[model samples]
Target: MDLDHEPATRAHEARLWRDDGWTAKVIKNGDDDGWAVEMTQEGEDEPALVGPWTMGRDKKNPKPLDSAAFITLVKTASEVLRRHEQQRHALLHKNVTIDSGSDRLRIDLDIIPDEYEPYAELSAHNGFGEELARVRVQPGFKLSRESAADWVANNFARPS
Candidate 1:
């Protein structure tokens, strides 16, 4: 079993710190003699944030990890993860409302990004949130005003 996956106990060291499900590690910068710090959430495979670290009073060593610094790093890394999740959600889900006959319909296209066979679900709902129609379409299906209008015009048939 990998130690990284094990339940963590609190640790506070000069170059490494772990607490509150987050770890901050300081490393030598690849491009220069300066140092860089990486912030990773527990059980995650990759660091959510990596940036330049502050130099110590000697200017040749990295600043020691402290309680305040670790707390700030966890906040920043959590925000980065949150933004990434939001962006991905926006990419996979789409919606538009359009006029259909006498009733307004909300059209949604939710993409399922499968590893080998990606697909999408095209669905429609009425103003009262009743399901009108649902069909599977190609993952690359475009869900725009004109495309939605065309679908509604076709009685919710699967788009070619």
Candidate 2:
């Protein structure tokens, strides 16, 4: 994300921080120079925090949004998110279900990071205690949760 360009055209402002399972970002209004902070928790569908922000030095109004500040904010926010994601991803185990009527399968993925080894375990099994397949995922892989959900809905699931 390039903060050099005005975020006016963007739908959402840059994220600022992610801590305690919550990610915060600063959103700006295109119509006016209004600013708001948005905090979204991991696995949440919506933001947990949304409120007005203080304007720059010109106490009367918010400081005009600019590239330098925007870039700094984005960099800091991204780091927060990255650290939070890494920590959470390391300790939490995710369970994903893919069912096809008569055949119901549950996929369990455990992410672990250690001094010598760091990887995610992907395993699939039927409702009955039967294993189907297992694979290992590298830590560096880019997994877009939103994109994955969209792909499953559009390609695998029936259209509503």
Best by TM-score: 1
When summed lDDT is taken over every stretch of 10 residues in candidate 1, the lowest stretch is 1-10
lDDT of 1: 0.94
- Each model's lDDT comes to 0.94, 0.56
- Report the C-alpha lDDT of model 2 over 1-160, residue by residue, as the tens digit: 3446432323323335444444556667555677776555556667644556657676544554345554454455557668977878655576666664577666666677766988866556778959766666664434344422442445322212
Model 1: per-residue lDDT, tens digit, 16-110?
Answer: 99988889999999999999999988888899999999999999999999999998898899999999999999999999999877899999999
Candidate 1 residue spans exceeding 4 A from truth: 1-5
Error of 1 at 112 (Å): 0.4
Estimated TM-score for each candidate = 0.94, 0.32
